[model samples]
Target: MEKFIGLVGTNSDNSTNRKLLQFMEKYFADKAQIEIIEIKDLPIFNKPEDKQIPEQVQLIADKIDAASGVIISTPEYDHAVPASLINALNWLSYGIFPFVDKAVMITGASYGTLGSSRAQLHLRQILDSPELKARIMPSSEFLLSHSLQAFDEEGRLNNGEHIEKLEGLFEDFLTFVKITNQLNHAHSINKKEAENFSWEEI
Candidate 1:
């Protein structure tokens, strides 16, 4: 089976975002192997002069680099993704280009009706940055609003409509990953550019 990384985009123990990823890991077990990667263990990014990542961050980066694709489930915080997710991305891009040209799918859940719309848009901009350059699955989004009640005791989404949409997007992502791998002719150049990238120069 194909392997994917379900990146939990928050550090909160009670995060619905984490629950969403867990649900995906199980619900999509037949289609792919989804390994849920957490960012809770990582510390804040300080942009160290040496450009060395924390041990845990490196381990997480390796998993992402090796994965066929990534699914990021985020929560809205101040109309944007949580600080923890930003911190994790910062560390991942400091010296490693694990996300370069990698297929990515953005999903978000929220207590409100917009379903983290703003946060998802912000994340898209971040992933499109020069250092990240993730090949995001476009024109598709899985937004789970009223997330607190979106799942049942079994941790599965209760809404048939939501499940239907999610299933379609997940299948789209699988195809997207295969198509993205074909666009890797410039992968080395992208990685080199990212490794030598600096904010001060731009």
Candidate 2:
């Protein structure tokens, strides 16, 4: 079965983004394994001092390294990704480099009309940087605006249109992950073949 890591951008226990991830876990349970990683336990990034990663951070890194894809649910804070999420990414980029060439899908929930759109854009830019090099899905954004009303008492999405869109996004993301993994495997094989080729004089 394909494994995917789910991360919530905020540290709040009651964050709507977290609920959104839970909903996704239930919605896609049969299709894939979605394991939610808690950001609350991660230490604030301190660069050189943090070279020796904490056990919790290493655990998350290991999961990401083993996963077929990653899904992030983020909330906008001051028009950007929450600090906790940024810090976690910083740690991953330092040495783990788990995001390199990995398939990623970004979504967000917010009280505002834009629904964390600005934060997701910023995150895409960060993931595209040389150090990270994450391959994020280019279409079918899953932003949830006015998030308070987006879900029902039972925690399922209230809007049928949004549910349809999310299902479509998940399907596309799975395809993207599979294709990307195959391409990477092929590239590695080709590189190994090229390296083993012997040149001879005719």
Best by TM-score: 1
Candidate 1 least-lDDT 10 residues:
193-202
TM-score of 1: 0.98
RMSD of each: 0.8, 6.8
Off by over 4 Å in 2: 185-202
Instruction: For candidate 1, write residues 78-129 as lDDT tens digits.
Output: 9999999999999988888899999999999999999999999999999999
TM-score of each: 0.98, 0.89
lDDT of 2 by residue, 146-195 (tens): 99888899999999988899999999999999888876754444434433
Q: Give, for candidate 2, the lowest lDDT window spanning 10 residues.
A: 193-202
Question: Could you tally the backbone clashes for each prediction?
Answer: 0, 0
Q: List pairs with backbone clashes in candidate 2.
A: none
- TM-score of candidate 2 versus the correct structure, residues matched by position: 0.89
Residue 53 of candidate 2: its Cα lDDT? Answer: 78
